[model samples]
Target: MLVRCSLLLPLLVWLAPAQGALERVDDFALLDQHGEFHQLSRYRHMRALAVMAYSADCPAMAEMAAGFEDLGHTLSDRDIAFLFIDTQGLDRGQLRGLELELPILDDGGRLVSAALEFGQAGEVALLFPERLSLFYQGAAGAGFEQTLDAVLAAEVTNSIADSIRAPLEAGCPLEFPVRETMLAEAPDYAGEVAPRIIENCGMCHRRGGVGPFALDSHLMLLGWSPMIREVLLNKRMPPMQVDPHIGHSRDAQYIAAEDLQVLVNWIDAGAPGPAGEADPLLALAEAPAPGWQLGEPDYIVQAPRQDIPPVGVLDYTYEETELGLGEEKWVRALQYLPGDQSVLHHLMSFVTGEGEDFWGAERRQENSTRRFLDGYAPGQDLLREFQPGTGVRIRPGEKLSMQFHYVTNGQSTSDATRIGLYFYDEPPEREIFTDAVSTRFLLPPNVPEFPLRASRRLERDAVLTGVRARMNFRGKKMKFAYQAPGEPLREIFSVPAYNYGWQPYYRLDEPIAIPAGATLHVIGAFDNSISNPNNPNPDAELRFGVESWEEMFTGYFTYHHAH
Candidate 1:
C-alpha cells in the first residue's frame, strides 16, 4: 500500500484546480527514454513524488545517482514514487545502462524541468500529499532521511490547499533581517550560503566561467567570499550595463534583484545562519556530460582542423565546406558544437550558391551584405524551434561558409568543428529575413573622436523587427532608430555603454511598428585613443575594415513581411 507523505498533501490538493504550483504542472508531459509519454497525473495516487533533475553526462551527477538509489531503497516500503528527469536534452539510449532503480524521464523541451525551478546540478524536491506542499528542497548533503520521515508523518487532510483553491494574491512581500548577525549564529559555510551562490554566481564564475576560479563547493566560496563581496559591490560580477527600468528581461544565468540582496546581506552579516538540515537538492544528475542536447545529430559537418600557434593576436579565419544537397533542402534547425569551447570565441554561418563569395560581397561594396542563416556566441542556447512550415533553405551545390574568431590562450590547439543540421522535406511556414546597416566611412589615426554613422531606407513597407548591433571594444555607443516617410523618429534600441565581451542580440518584446518607405538609421561613436582599454593599437591609424582593430558600423535586422 502507498504510504503518502504529508509534505506532498498541499501539492496534491492544489493539483486538482490547477493554479500556482499546481497550475504550473497541469499541462506537463515529457518523453521517457523509449520516446514514451510520461504524464504527471499518472503518478497522482503515489504517496509522494521525488523529482530529480539530471544532465546527460555530468560526472558529479553520476556519482550522486548511487546515493539516490540508496535513498530509493530506504523509502521503497513507504509507497513513494521516484522519477528522474533529464533536464539537458540527452538521449535515453546513451543513459540506458546506468544501474538505477527508477524511471528516468527526458525533459528535452525543458517544460516541466524549468517549471520545477530545477537548478543546473543536483536538486531534489519532496512532495507531501497532506498539504500538497514541498516539505524540503536543497542540494545534496545530509539530513535527507530526517526530512523524509517528517514529511511522511504529517497527516493528509481534505481541506483544499491555498495554492489550488485560493486565488493567488498579488506577489507576497519578502522579509529579510537587515541587521547583521554574530558569527555564532552563522550557518555552516556550505549548508547556508552554497545554494545562494550556486544560483547566482556559479554560472559564470565556474571553471568555464569567464572568471578565474570555480565556486562548485563550500570551501571555494569561503576562500573567495572577500573577493566575491568586492566584485558584487563594484558591479563587476555581471558584466552588462543595461538600464533596468527601460528593459530588464530574463535569460540563462540572470540573477534576480532579491537574490542579489540576499547575497549582499549574507556577506554583510558575515554569512550567518543556524545549522538547518542537509540540502535535499542534489547537483543535476549526470552533469558535465558531453553530447548533443537533442540526442545525436542527423548529419555532422566537421571543419578542417587547424592548429592555433602559441602566442600573438589571432585574426578572423574563414573555412568553407561543400554540403552536397542533391536538391533544395529545408533546414528546420542547426546545432554548432565547438571542438574546443574554451578557445573558440565566436562563429558566424552563411549559406551561398555554388562558388559565390559571401564574405567578399560585403567587403567589395558599401551597403552590401548577405543573408545570415544563424550565428552563435558563447552562453547562447540553440534558436527556439523555427515556426511551423518556416525553415532555412539551402539550394543544391551550395556551400556552408563559416567565419570563426579565435582568441589564443598561449597553447597550440586544433579544432575540428562540427555543425548538426536538422531538415524537413517540405517547405516551412515562415521565411527567414536579414537586413543590415553598413557604412562607407573611414577613421583617421589617433583621433580623439570620430562620428561614424550608417543608415538604410526600406524600399517597401516592411516591419522593423528584431535588432542587433555589432562592434569591437573601440565602440562607444550604438543606437538604432527609425523615421517614417514623414514622421518623427523613435529610437528602438540603444547601447549607451557597449562592451565587446557582452555583445547580445536584443529582441523587442513586441515588434516596433514602422510605416512604409521609412528610413532606419544606425549611429555609432568610436574611441580609438589610449583612453579605451580594449583598443589594440592606440597609435595605429584606424580604417574602415572587417578586422577587429579596424572599425565597422553595422546593425542587423530580422523581419517578417505579409504573405
Candidate 2:
C-alpha cells in the first residue's frame, strides 16, 4: 500500500535520511481502487516497489498515466510492482472512471504522502521492500528508467547504494495542508498524542502487559517515538491488521485518520515534553487488572496443567475436561483465564462428545460443521459474550476439548488455565453454530505463495455472526467472502497480513444475512519461503496435520439459523 518514511531522526541512525544518500523508508498499508489490499512489507517476495504520486488536478496526469503504464509493462518481467498513490482524496466512484490497471493507493489523509514526501504529482519513488531503501526519487520518465538501469547494474556489482539518486524538482506540486499546519505549530503533547496512545496502545503496552515496553510517561513516549512511528507506519502495532475498507468489527483496532495524523505529526515535531503537569498515561499504566468482565460465572472448569520446556518447538496438545454436569445448561459466554501468557501462545476450545477431541470431524473430512467454543489468541478480550438470545446449547455427558499451543520465551513455566462458563437460565431463542471450511494439500518447498481456497454451501438461511481463520507457521493471508444464488460475491472479513501469533476470532459489528443456496468461501495462501518471517522451515514439504508445526487451512463461520 502506502509504506513510507519521513525526515527527522537523530538517535536512530538507521532511520536518518542524509542528503544525496539512499534514505530508509518505513512500511505502511492502504486499499487500492479495486478494494485490493497492498502493504509494502508484505511484498518481501519482490525486489522493489515503485510508486508514483498522482493527482487528477495535475495537467500532465494523462501523459504520466500512459508512461506509468509503459513502465509497468517494461518492468513486468522484473520482480518489481508498480503502484499509483492519490494525494487528493478521491472516492472509488471517481477513481473507477480512470480504469487504471495499476493499484492507485487511497492516501486520503495525506499521512503516507507526508511520510514519503510526495510533493509533486508524476514524481516516482523506487523502494526496496526487504531492505527499506530508496533507490531513486525523481520525475517518472527518462530519469526513472535511468535510475532503474543504474540499480540493475549495481545488482551485478553487489553495490546497491551506488545506484541511488537524489530528488529532482520537476513535476506538478501537490499541497499538503495538514502537514503545513502541523509543521507550523508544535503538537500539544498533553492534548494531542497521549490520549490517542492511551486509547489505542495502552492495553498491551503497559508495564506488565505483553508489550516490550511501557508507555507510563511522556518521557517514555519521547524515547520510543521512533519505534512507535515505525510500528504504526508498518501497521504492526494495534496488532489487529484487518482491512477497514471491508467489513467493520468492534474489536478491530483502528485509529482515525485525524488521530493518526496527530500522532505522527506530534512525533515528527521533536516529541516535546508535556507543557502541563497533568499526565493521563500514568493512571492507565498503574491501574489494577480487572477479572471476569461479565462477573463470576455459573460454573468454572479447570484445564490440566501444561509444563512448557525452557526451549524448543512444541506440537499442539489436546486435552479434554469432563464437565461432570448433573444437568444440561444453555451457555451464553465463556472466559479464558490463561495461567501463563508468556509461554502459552494460544488455545482453541470446543464442545465435543465424550471420546472426541478438538479435531472432531476435521481429520477425516475436508469440511464439516463442528462445535467451536472459542479460538483464543494474544491481545484479544478474554471474556466473550455472544448476542443476548443466541448461545450454544450444552447437554450432559458433553466434554470440553481444549487445544493448547505454547511458544517458549526463554523460560520454563507451567500453565493450568481455567474457563468460566456463563449459562442462560432458560434456553435461548436461537442457537449459535459453527461451520468449518478446510482444505488439504501437499505444499511444495521454498514456494513464495501457494494459493488455497475452501468453500461450503449453506443448507438453509443463516445469519453469520463471526469468522476465524486457522493456519500454522507458513500462513500468509486469508479472506472470508460469500455469494448468493443471484448476487455478486461479497467479502465479509480479511486478514490482509496474517500473523500466526494473533489469530483472534473476528466478530463482525454487523452480522450478514445469507439465504439458502449460498456458498461461503475462504481464500488464502501460504508463504513457504525465506521471505516469510514466521516460517519455521521453508524447505519442509508439509501436509495437513492437527499439530501447529504441520500446516492446516481452516476457516470457521459462526452463525445462527434464520428459521
Candidate 3:
C-alpha cells in the first residue's frame, strides 16, 4: 500500500538546500544519546539503510518505533542498517534517558534532516547504496510495513524509487560558482558593508542583540562564515520584506540587496582587514545615553507603577493612564523608555476615545488593565521619523492607553513607563495603515508538537506592507508570504527564531508590489509540550484568545491600498 509520509518528518528541513534523488548528506557533526559523535558519511557504504526520524515524546512516533524495530529485525539478515534519527529538540541529557533501542543520532541542529528532506518528525526513508535511491518512503503508520517489506524483498526497485534516490549525489553541490557582477572587486568588509550591517543587522546580531549569535566582530562573523553567505544568497537573512524599489523605511530591520552583496563579497574575500585606522562602524556610532536610544521626550506618559515579586513566573499585568491631548497633533516620531529596562520585556499602546477605557474591559475580563496604543519590545528602539510626509495623528481628548508585559530575571523590581512624542505642526503627504491577520484554532493539551497555519487573501490588492505577529512563548517559527494574482507566491518575511520577549514589526525597504487581488498567507508553528521549555503549561489545552496567557495566531499587516 502506498503510504503518505508528508507529516512524519520534522518541519525544520523546509530551509534545506534542494536536492534530487541519491543525495549525499553534507558535512555536519551531531551527538547521539550516549554523547557519541555521528557523522553523515558513516552510512555511505551500507547496501541499504533506513533513516527513521522519531521523537520520544510523540505517541505516534512511539507506535512507529515498534514497526521500525520489526523492520530492523527483518532486514538484519540482509545486512541493511536501521539508523534512527532523533529530531526532537532535546539536549543530550534528556535524549540519553529515553533509552531508544535503535542506533539513534541527534539532529538537534537540524542539518541532517534538512539535507535529507525528512522534515516531519516520524518519517522513514529506505536508502539503497547501489543506485543511491530511496526504495521506500512513508509515515510512521501501519502502511510503512509494506514499504519495509518491499525494501527487504527487493520489490521496490522500480523507476519511482530510483528517481527519488538517484539525485542525492548531486543534491547540494559543495562549490558555489562565483558570479561576475558589476561591483565584483570584493567589497571591503569594514568600510563598505559594516556600516550597513550596524544599521540594519547589528541591532539584533550584536553581543546582546535579540538574535542567538553575534555578528559584531570579525571572529564571530568567521565562525558562522558559510551559513551567513548561504542565508543571504537564499534571501533568508536580515529577515525583512524584500521590495527594493519603493516605500519609506518604517522599521530598522530592513537591509538592501546591495548591502547583502557587500557582506557576501566581504565574506567571500576572507573578510579582509579594514582599509584605514578610523573604524567606520565606530565612526558611525552616535551612541545614546544609558537609558534611552532616543533623547528625553517632549511628553512623558507614565503607567501606574507596580512592584514585581522575585522568583516566580508573573501573570500578565496591565496598567492604564489618560493622555489628554488637548488638541489634534501630528506625531512625527515617538520613543518608549522603560523605567527599569532589564525587567521590561514588552509593552503595547492603544488609542481610545476619552470615555472608552481598557480598565473597564480588563475588569470585565477579570484583569486589571486596558488595551495599548502601540507595541514595543526589547531591541526595539523608540519609533523614529518616517519620510517627511507620514505621521500618526493624535487628536484632542483622545486617551493614550498602555500595557506592559514584564518578565523578571529573578529580581525584585518596580517599573514606571514613559513615552516621548515628536510632533509636526503641518500635515504630512503620505498615510499609514495597520491591519491585523488572525486565525481560529484549538490546541489540544499534551498532543506532541503539530503544525498550525492561518492565511487570508487580500480582498483587494494593496501596495506597501509591513507585519507584526504575536504568539505565546511556545511559537517555533512564523512566515508571511504573498501570492500575487497571477504570479508565483513569494515569501516576504519569515521569523525562523521566534522569541516571545522580542517581537518587532518588520518593514520592507522597498514596498512589495501586489496586484489588486493578491493574497497574503501567514503561517506559524507551535510547540506546546513540556519539551518546549517556554510552554507555560505542558498540559493546558490552548484555544484562541487575545490575552497573553492564552494562545493566539495573529498577523498585523500595515499597508497602503493602491489608488
lDDT by residue (1-563, candidate 3, tens digit) is 01222323222221133232333333333445653333333334345667787666555666667778877887776757777876655666677677777768765543345445564556777665555445555564444555455455543332332222212211112212222331256666666766766776665565433355666565566788788766654334555332322233455344543565467656656766566555555532333334445566666777788787655766667655667777777666777766765566677766666666443343233112222235666556556554466656667777776656766556687888777777776876545555555567788876434567666666665764566667777665576777876789777766544556556666566777677677677766776754454677867888776677787666666665565
lDDT of 1 by residue, 399-508 (tens): 88887766665667777767888887677765656677778666665553566778777776555445667777677567777888668977776655456655555545
Cα lDDT tens digits for candidate 2, 44-87: 77777899988998898889888897888888878788999988
- lDDT score for candidate 3 against the true structure: 0.57
Best by lDDT: 2
TM-scores for candidates 1 onward, in order: 0.59, 0.90, 0.52
Q: Whole-model Cα lDDT per candidate?
A: 0.57, 0.79, 0.57
- Candidate 1's error at 409, in angstroms? 5.7
Off by over 4 Å in 1: 1-196, 199-201, 207-212, 225-236, 245-256, 268-287, 295-298, 306-313, 354-360, 407-414, 444-449, 461-465, 507-513
In model 3, the Cα lDDT at residue 132 comes to: 41
Query: With candidate 2 superimposed using the best TM-score fit, by how many Å does residue 215's alpha carbon deviate from the native?
Result: 1.4
Query: Which residue runs of candidate 3 sit more than 4 Å off their true CA positions?
Result: 1-298, 354-374, 456-461
